[model samples]
Target: MTAEKALLGCMMKENHLIGDTIIKAGHLADPRHQALFKQMRDRHQQGGTIDLVTLSTTVDLEPFGGISYLHDLQSFANVEKFAEYEELVLEKWKEREKRNILTVAKEEDWEIQKVIHALDQINEAKIDDHIAISTGLADLYEAPWQEENQIKGISTGMLRLDQMTNGFQDGELTVVAARPSMGKTDVMLHFAKQAGWNGDLPIIFSLEMPNKSLIQRLVASTGAINRLKLRNPYQHLTEAQKEQWPELIGRVSETNIQIFDGAGQTVAQMRAKVRKLMHEYPDKKPLVLIDYLTLIRPEHHYGGNAHMQVTEISKQLKGMAKEMNCPVLLLAQLNRAVEQRQNKRPMMSDIRESGSVEQDADVMIFLYRDAYYDQDADPKHLELIISKNRNGPIGTVFANYNQFTGGIRDAHD
Candidate 1:
């Protein structure tokens, strides 16, 4: 209340302060203050004096105990600390806005993304937009010595991969790309399962596959059951495998994972789902997985051009990762041109639809299984090429992939 009064006083005292302070009608919490500031703003904009006499004639000051309240507001004004008072008023306004947003969110009419975006806009007034470089020097100097700061990320559960990439860091958009039938889904699911098993919440948006098929794969991988047998459980499973059903169910039930099997979902829908989940489980850290990016349909039609649509989606996903403070592991496909090349390994240029997919991803991983092309090649051998890692070294981690069991093991293992 005092800060609100002080802000109003500053506006009335020196009309020029209005532009300098950047105060708005919403910033003043008190209705009386808001009315007074509005009048002052109007007067200043119209080249009129914003003194008490002019304000008294223009606004209805009767409800605020007549002109005496305005006098008290003037007494509270301190020009030297005007900025500090403005900051306090803005902070209080933000808190009120947050409560209002949450209240509106409780109503069924409001979409979760709308509420989230509203909250984001309200908190966008950053206090430290400008800072001295020396202030960050200490943190940078100490970062190497601090173990916690060294790897500020969650584990993907692949040892060699984790060692090479330091897990998927927060605020990063990672793209895992592969040619068709090269085990991209299997490898990605394996990483998701690892993170889920470790209690890191994994939210999967499987645009291509249904939830049942995904669950069957999870059951096969976690329980070491054959994928085909797991698919036809009651009939195809052996007597021994049938006995492992309870444990397989238990293994799946214990993971902190949620799968959304929505085909052709737009970026907006995916963000809304993520925001909904985050609001529901506020405590857990979320890892968003979008299986094969190009399959996702754009919310707004981009003139029937697939490349433009995919590019927008990729950019939005990257921004969402930063805004949501989560790691987004998006699966993508290499262009069919990779298949024509003698070496089937994918390059950064091979990311389908748009080069922006590669440009936006903080880490770009390509899954290559030689056996997919060469029938006689070792089926178990796989390579995870970290072609572009913005925060770490780019390299390849060799691993063994069991096609039937859908299990991945480090090469040394």
Candidate 2:
């Protein structure tokens, strides 16, 4: 009661300071103080005056004492110390609710509804630390002009791809579709390494591949060593390859990349796991890479249809990326339609099982290698088709794909 009186007094003196405290009228222990504070806060919220004159006009000041009583309240608190008083008031409110909950629990045949309501009230008292966007419109509008906010997108390490999509922006889903052995996994791994090397946390959810295989690919790609050498370095490695192993081992160890071998995992389970990671590393922004969309199971079975399940998973993954405020780099397979066609280039329509994957993606990149189908075709030049780029230009970029190392880099790199 004393703390609440002090806070209300401070607010009366400095009306603008009310916004700094998390305390609400309902949090005040005393009924009279709650009523007075509620009327003051209501006036403030409405953009009306918040002085004693305005407060008295809205809330009756009779039995609670007259206008004189309000004047005397200022002596009880100082405006400079309002935050300390706010904390004190909140603590008292929590204690009062805890006592009420305990009192209810002791009753025989206590209604579950009452207990649940009490617990909910307790939970609502927690202070939120997230910035209030409702009050930051001016800052948000000016953000693009500011140097720090100018480059908001995450870099993909490929110049043309970055230019095409401004890299992958946060709260977006980017789908990379490729036919069998066209290097979908390799492209995403290259992106993951790019983010990791830049000191951001990158997570890989490998539904189609195991962690060991992914690591082998990472080693092969980073070291420029043959994939076969990675599988059994003892036998296949040349003298130069063996000499370079120590440096490559150190490079992989230094990268801040985390992988999840989530074979057959549902989207709901992935959400729960990712949420846990977000909570664990609140400061680090994560780049989520799902190996392939088709392998992920939906939490609720949508009949026995694979396409419908994928559609649901695609939508949910897109939502999850927005909810988690991160970019989701999803790898997917192009259907056999691409193989049957003479062009052999994948389109948005070729995303296997679900067209929703293409619809949900902010950017859709397709990997195609001419060498994959032709014996005399150039193996070094792999084509990356940006079929759909929601934010930037759609075009094709070429990179050198080293099949032995499973590495892809800009052709001119």
Candidate 3:
């Protein structure tokens, strides 16, 4: 007999339903197996669903083994009985858990089983309500004040934004808005830099900028140089600014910053990519920076709604931030309607076509530049207009914009 069969013979109990091991050694090495294991590990770590398309790279089943083989082998490999496998795994875990104090649920389960030992006691205690009773027990461990205090999950970023937010508290969504050439992305990059220092590497899904440009912008921000100047420093800068570029790149390298190459991501596709990154970087409850919210591809058609589709997308992304326990920094475009108004400054009503963008966010911040309007004024003074501070005080904060570095610093108070 094969050594595997001999091992199984000794391990198998008389009552145990032991299936013969059908080791498709070739299929075991198939990439699907490896991909499946990795996907399973990630899904368990980051509480989310992994659909087949989003779950793995191995699509074709031919390499995974034949249909006839898969049918018989799925049963033999113990794949079909996952519920049973999970129980067995948990039981094994309990056996090894030296600290496990025969939990109250376990005791209660056994108590109910003992009472059910005889048919006469079956109606005495309600077994159908057991799941509800067990789940309600969580209330015993929860503290009312503790629960109240932890209502929002703040993105551990800037004091100004955090003060406005109490930080992007758990389950709350945030949106950042600005006009074209308004440096909306610049502000979000600054926020991401701050988050990185807190050991939280926010994942940026930039469909507008390439990953390298994004890195350069970060390097510029960290260096406090205008990213535009960094790209053409020799053309625009003096010798002193030239000397600062290397030191800037070196400084940004110290932070825990990470970016995803999301050049053409649809909403569904972005979800899969972000979920993978979140799992990979478990400590960084990634702050997702979508360059602007309008470019996102919807999950499905909403009867040719150009505006409502954008609304649905924003609402879903904000919902995702809450469910995944991550802060979503959704960059938005200000409607040109701002340009037509007597006052050019953007308001809550100016978040392009969709009211949902304004409605979905816990905080809405706008970036406006005077240089965009006037020819003579300095471009350095960028205004941070807190259009809607749902949870905190609404106001403006002035920051110095380094045109060369794409960096923002709080202007003189």
Candidate 4:
């Protein structure tokens, strides 16, 4: 209370102090103080005066101890100690917010994940550190020299695509969109295989497929094993392939990959799970891979408004990427509008509920296979269209797609 009173007093005494501090009206403990601070801040923002004479006319000062309490507050005002009082008020506010969160959680019987997320929200809002433009300019000047011949981000395992994108970057959201059987999942698995092999952790959320199916695809991708042969090895596998099964399975098992095949996963649940993995594997950088977007359950239903739900989910996923300091590779399905087109190639607008997804994505790649629509076209030819690259150029990179094995790889490979 003392800190809040002193801070509000300083702001009222020096009207300019209201704009200098990040303190909000909610930071005040006393109801009257909250109301008074809000009025002062509002008036200052409007370019109006914030003195007692002005406030007394605009606001009912009776509840705020009339003009007498204003004098009492003014007595404690010290513009020189404004920063100290502002910090003290923020500290107390944070403490109160944390306690309130815990109390609400207990009363509502909220899940532990929800409680952690609420607490995290409080921490994220606690501080604002602004840096000068020159600091960023200095780093930008040195970046090219420092990263001259290296991949600046996690490798996508495709040489041409990697050359174009420099791989999926940290603090970014990369969306891979395609029609059914266009190898969207295969492309994600390709990235996961590369990330795992490079000593980075690939955390996969397979909302559409079971863990067993994903493992089969991974084994097929890593070992070049035929997918059908794995289904019924007794009939499809030859003696030579049968003898090689142990090594192929063992190779995939060695990579650091974690798969969650649960349905209706919310972003908060995924965040909590990822946080746990980060604590366990502090040394390994994690790449979060969600099989598809629409399947993700929103925290709150929007009366079946898919667009609103997707908007919320995409925003949260982008936030999660920056907060975790890692890349998030999200798979999405293209709408029927793509099939209606003459070219049948996907555009940003083809994404289902695309408004927010397109806006939130730092990178967007569309997968196209000519053979899917044309029987005479080359089945192995796949075009990875880089439709959007926020940090680099956008172009198409060709890759080999093996339908039999569910594998997507560099064309030259």
Better of 1 and 3 by TM-score: 1
Model 4 global lDDT (CA atoms, 0 to 1): 0.85
Angstrom error at residue 400, model 3: 2.0
Give the best candidate by TM-score: 4
The lDDT for every candidate, in the order shown, is 0.80, 0.79, 0.60, 0.85
Model 3 misplaced regions, further than 4 Å: 1-157, 226-229, 232-247, 376-378
Question: Where's the lowest-lDDT run of ten residues in candidate 3?
Answer: 13-22
lDDT of 2 by residue, 1-413 (tens): 77777888888887875654557777877788878877787778788877678767877899569888788787787865665686577667777887888786876556865665465456334443477776788567877777674555778888887877887788899998898888888888999898888777788899978999999999999988878866678988898878878988889866678889968986656755665566566677788899888888764454576776776788778877876678988888878888788988888888888647878888888999889999799887799998888888898998988988888888763
Model 3 C-alpha RMSD vs. true structure (Å) is: 16.1
Backbone collisions counted per model: 0, 0, 18, 0
Better candidate number, 1 or 2, judged by lDDT: 1
Summarize candidate 4's per-residue lDDT along 236-302 as a digit string, tens digits.
Answer: 8888877988998887877779999999998867876776677578899999999989999976565
Which residue pairs in model 4 clash with each other?
none
Q: Residues 107-176, candidate 3, lDDT per residue (tens digit)?
A: 6555643432232221122212235666777865576556454454535345555555666655566787
How far does residue 229 in candidate 4 sit from its true spot (Å)? Answer: 2.2
Q: Which is better, 2 or 3, measured by lDDT?
A: 2
Better structure of 3 and 4 per lDDT:
4
Model 4 is weakest, by summed lDDT over 10 consecutive residues, at 120-129
Q: Which runs of model 4 end up more than 4 angstroms from their true locations?
A: 1-151
- Report the alpha-carbon TM-score of model 1 versus the true structure: 0.68
TM-score: which is higher, 2 or 4? 4
Q: What is the TM-score (0 to 1) of candidate 2?
A: 0.66
